[model samples]
Structures are given as C-alpha cells and as structure tokens.
Target: MEYSMLADIDTGEQSSQFLTFIMADEEYGVEILDVQEIRGWEPCTEIPNMPQYVKGGINLRGTIVPIVDLRQKFGFNNIKYITTTVVIVVKVLVEDKSKTMGLVVDAVSDVHTIAHSDINLPPQLGLDTGPRVIRGLVSIRDKMVVLLSSSLLLDLNQFQNIEQINEHKTQQPMATND
Candidate 1:
C-alpha cells in the first residue's frame, strides 16, 4: 500500500498490535504479526520497468525481497538517506500466500497497543490510499495515529510483478563449474 504518512501503529482493527515507523515526516503502523525483521538500509539491485517507489530487490540470504520506498510511493519530496533510514521486512499476504518484502522508512517509531474502542473512523479523502488502506485513527499521548489495513496495503498486481521478476531471475541459465 502507498503508506498513509499521517498514520500510526495498529492493525486497523480492535485491540491489535502495530510496528510504527516514520515516512515522509509522518507516522505509519503495520501489523506486528506481519513483521519479519527490521534492518538498516542497503543498496538493492535495481529492476527495470518498475515503479519509482519500488527502489529494487534485495537478496535476503536467498529470497529476492522487493524493497519499496514509502516516501516516493506517498509522493513525498526528494529525501536524502541518513543514519536513521531503515527497512522494515514484512511478510505480506497476497491471495492466501505469504510474500516477504521490505518497506523503506525514514525511521522507526515505537510499537503501540490499540484498544478496539479507541480507534476513530477515517475521514473522507481522495488520496491514492485505497479505501481499505487505512483502518482507523486514534489518539496517543495527545497525538493522532493512523491505523493501516495490513491486508489491503498492496494489491495483487504488485506482488505478481515481484514474483515475475524473481521467476525471470531464476530462469537464467547457470554457468557450469568447468
């Protein structure tokens, strides 16, 4: 999903856990259960014909995990990477299957526990964040947090594209140890 930069930590559901992060000077949260690991930024191999927000793919041990720049995806202005830059590796579920991907963020905020009743309904906006992208809003420490609908963050097409790229990479013939 193109992140709702104004968002905060939660599952977009009642009493859910979230891993909060910062992007484009805003806060966003994803389901903690979906998070695999958090790592610092590293250059990834660029893939041709992909969206600008898709920075590229990284070889995580053996899996080719696609890295998405939340800033660009959210249409944030040009930003320079700094020590706080990080990649939040998350296990995304697409069509009953799980795929690993990385979300690049300016920095990571803290995890927050959201009670079911505390979440406020989302306001109407014509943003690119599809209807299901944002779950709700809540106040924390007198700050508003935006909860994201983890399931709807990305559509099938993006995952399909990543899969195709990975398949293409694997199809390349290997050199013999002659």
Candidate 2:
C-alpha cells in the first residue's frame, strides 16, 4: 500500500507520512507519492552485461520496469529469497525524466509520520556511498529510519541502459501469420 511521502523538508513543516521497509537490521523509507505498487517477488529476464545489483527487467503491463536489489545495491551478500521477499515498484526522477522501476526488498514495514525537525543529516564518512543518496536520519519507536533521496536513486548511466532496453523491446516486431 502507498502512503504519503515526505513533504518539502526545506520548509520544516508538520509531520509527513513515510512508507518503511526492512533491509538487514536497518529500516529505510521513501516518499510514498513516488510508489507505484507493492508486489511479491517474481523471476525477471536477466540482462547481460549489467550491474549485479540490477537483478533484471520485468514487464509491468506493457512497460519494461527494471528491478534493483537494494541489498546488493548497498554491498550486501545475496540472501535466500523467502516468502517475505517482495518487489516495491517506485518512480524515480533522473535528468528531468521519471522512470519506473522495482526494488527487491526483504519485506515492507509500517508507515509513520515524522516531523521535519526530527530528521538529522547523516554523518560524513568519506565512503564511496555518497551522503547525497540519503535524505536524513529519524527515530521512530526506538528505531532509526534512513530516508532515501529518490532523485539520486540510481546512477544516470543505469537509467540510460534501462531506457535503451525499453526502446529495444518496443521496436521489436510482433510475430503473426499474414
């Protein structure tokens, strides 16, 4: 189910709803407005010569939506896909274009409303995982929620590959008897 995403943080407004999901021991969230749907994990058509994190692409209706494994994306070991494994469909922005993709997560959690004041900036660690990817840190029910920045969800080059794959799929000829 989709919940309301965070409002403009710069404004320091009232509490905003966020959809939370579990990844290992940590909980992460994203704007609910950007979410398309939540679905059970399904096998996808593996693409050659793509990043390991890019699990593959799935046909959503008629659109080719790329699937991303967040565990692998965050440099984690491949775990067994269980009944809880699910794919969260989300729309992300890249270079003024909105692209739809599926994020393979362990399982989804509860939704909570957090005020802008509660969010704290993530500490700079000088690591390859840039701080820009994270929006901020917030505490709820004695747990810390790491908010993600949808704008920087994936690398620009990855989006290009996904777009190309989509175009290539659409350009293929349909088989029929004349």
Candidate 3:
C-alpha cells in the first residue's frame, strides 16, 4: 500500500512520526515522511556481483527499485519470507538526489509520534554500526526502538555504485551464448 499520501499532521514542535518495523526481534523505525509505500514480500530480479545484503531489484511502476534485506545487512541469518514479511519503500537523499529503494523487513509494527526529548543518542561504542545508520534510540510502550537514518542506511558511495552498474547494464545489450 502507498504510504506516501499519509500526511504528517503532528503539530507538536518537537515531535515526529516514525514507521516502525521488526527485524531479528529488534524494533527499528524510520521517519514516516521518507516512506513511499509498504509492499508484501515478492521475488525480485536478482542482480549479479552485488553484496549479499542486496537482495536485488524490483520494477515498481516504471522505476527499478533496489531491495535491501535488513536481516542480512545487520549480520543475521537468512530467514524465510513469511506472510508477515514486508518491504518498506523509502526515499533517501544522496548528493542532492532523491533515490527510492525498498527495505525487506520481518514485519511492520506501528507508527508512533516521538518527542525530541524522548530520543536518546546511541552510545559511542566501538562499533561499525553507529550514528551513521542509527539516528537515535527511543522507547515506546516499554519497547526500545532504534530510530534509523534511512539516507545513511544506504551508504552514499555504495548506492552510487549500484546506480552506475544499473545504468551500464541498461545501456548495454545482453550477450548471447549462441
């Protein structure tokens, strides 16, 4: 379903709405404004020589949206894509350009309005996964939600490479084995 039309009417000065989802039993959230749509699990056209976390790309309308498996991206084992599996289509900004991609998650949770004060900055632990992807940590209904920075989640350098490869593939004709 298209979540693009969902308006952010939260007038609170220091609050924002986030669309939460589950992956490996952990709850994660992204700003609702960045969401384009929510889709059910669907097979995609697998691309060759891409990272393991990059599941592949799917044709959404006229655009070929790349899909990233969050579980694999987060160093988790591959699980079956059940009925609850969903793809959250999000728009991210990179170098002044807007890119659309889908994130494969276990299941979508809920949208919660979080006040600025409620979000706690993630600790500066000696870990690769830092503020680059995780924006902050918030608690909702006693559950901790890792707020994510969608733009940073898809690394700019890596994403540009994917786009370049996609463009090159489209411009070149397929080779025949005859």
What lDDT score belongs to each candidate, Candidate 1 first?
0.80, 0.84, 0.86
Instruction: Write candidate 3's Cα lDDT for 1-178 as tens digits.
Output: 5443333365534677899999999999999999999999999988677788889899888567889999998899899999999999999988888999999999999998787778999888787754378889998989889998898766765677678766876888879999
TM-score result, candidate 3: 0.84
Which candidate leads the pack in lDDT?
A: 3
Residues 75-117 of candidate 1: C-alpha lDDT, one tens digit per residue: 8886888899999998877788988889898999999877767
- Which lDDT tens digits does candidate 2 get at residues 140-178? 889889988766767888878878888998899999999
Top-TM-score structure, candidate number: 2
**Clash number by candidate, in order:** 3, 1, 0
Cα deviation at 3, candidate 2, in Å, is: 15
Model 3 ranges with Cα > 4 A deviation: 1-12, 165-178
